[model samples]
Target: MEQKEKQILVSIISSIVILASYSLYVYHKFMAGNPGIINDFRFWGRAFLILIPVAIMAQIIIHIIFAIIHKIVTDEDLSTKNDERDKLIELKSIRISHWLFTLGFFLSMGSQAFGKPPWVMFITLICSGFIASIASEGAKIFFYRKGL
Candidate 1:
């Protein structure tokens, strides 16, 4: 697999895993009646901050591991350079992702307006964004395999 595709795969998978794990943990806390997790704005704010880094680090580590394994298997270094087609694929993916985000944002806002709690709003926003990103990455991988 190409380096970019590998990176995208790692990023999407890692982000999903991290988000799911965090959500499950918070849900458990909510069920246990732990204060400031599912109902508190402050808790969500802190959780968001923590989640960002954990997701980012997971991507970085996964990407590195994939690179090392790819090198060992292929006996060649993964190229860091991107070509024109790569840039075009990225742009197209981002364009689609933008639409996804806009749609998701509106949905999130609608949920907020419908009197959902803070935690619900938080999950809606985060999940929409994550879905958008995953969709974009999936598009990139598809385009890469499809070629120019």
Candidate 2:
């Protein structure tokens, strides 16, 4: 297979693995019966403050795994870095992300007409928009590289 095909396959596999791990983590958390939401400022502080580092670490690890896979599968040396095409693809991906985030934000706002707590709706919208942006970027990169 071509390098592009290999890269696309690796991207799909990596995405599936990361998503599955996240799903399992959520399931485990559910099974452990964590509180739905700690309304207390002290508990929320401790919980999300600790979680920020954990989330960053997880992203680092995922990037590392992608780097390793690219090194193994591609002819070019790993340190031989991103080219013009890569930058263009990334730029396009960011444009796509913007649209996705806007869509998610507006959709979430529309749902708030049902009269939920403003904070809850706002936070949910933010998180969903963030996820949608990431997913849109990924899809844009894959499609641009793989030509589909």
Candidate 3:
């Protein structure tokens, strides 16, 4: 596999690990103790707010660790610069991610419109975000492999 594909694969794995562990933590730490908190707007808001920074920081740390391990294993530094093709691939994947997330956002609102509980909307949003991230990374890998 090329470096870009490997990097994207690592990103996908890291995202899955971060989201799964975080969701489990939240379920046990708060939701399991008080199931009623699921409908609480404040609880959802706090979770979203906390998750953003946590996800960003975790991604950074995970990527740094990946870079170090990759270096030690291959004795090669991952490319840090993006040329035209790289830029195009990034832009295309980002467009895909944007559209998926936008669809998810509308679906979340639709859940509320249908009289679903607030937790449903929150869960939908979270799922959409996670799916979008994975899809974007997967798109990048595909594009790289296809020589696009």
Best by lDDT: 3
Tens-digit lDDT track of model 2 for 99-131: 777877776687677775454554565466456
Per-candidate clashes, comma-separated: 0, 0, 0
Off by over 4 Å in 1: 1-3, 27-31
Number of clashing pairs, model 3? 0
Q: Write the per-residue lDDT of candidate 3 for residues 1-148, one digit (tens) a residue.
A: 8898888898999999999999999999998969899889999999999999999999999999999999999999999989999999999999999999999999999999999998999999999999999999999988888877
**Residue range 24-96, candidate 1, lDDT tens digits:** 8766865466655467677778878988888788778877888899889888887888889889999999998
Q: lDDT of each prediction vs. the true structure?
A: 0.82, 0.59, 0.94
After the best TM-score superposition of candidate 2, give how far the Cα of residue 48 lies from its true spot, in angstroms.
Answer: 6.6
TM-score of each: 0.85, 0.56, 0.97
Judging by TM-score against the true structure, name the best candidate. Answer: 3
lDDT of 2 at 40: 41
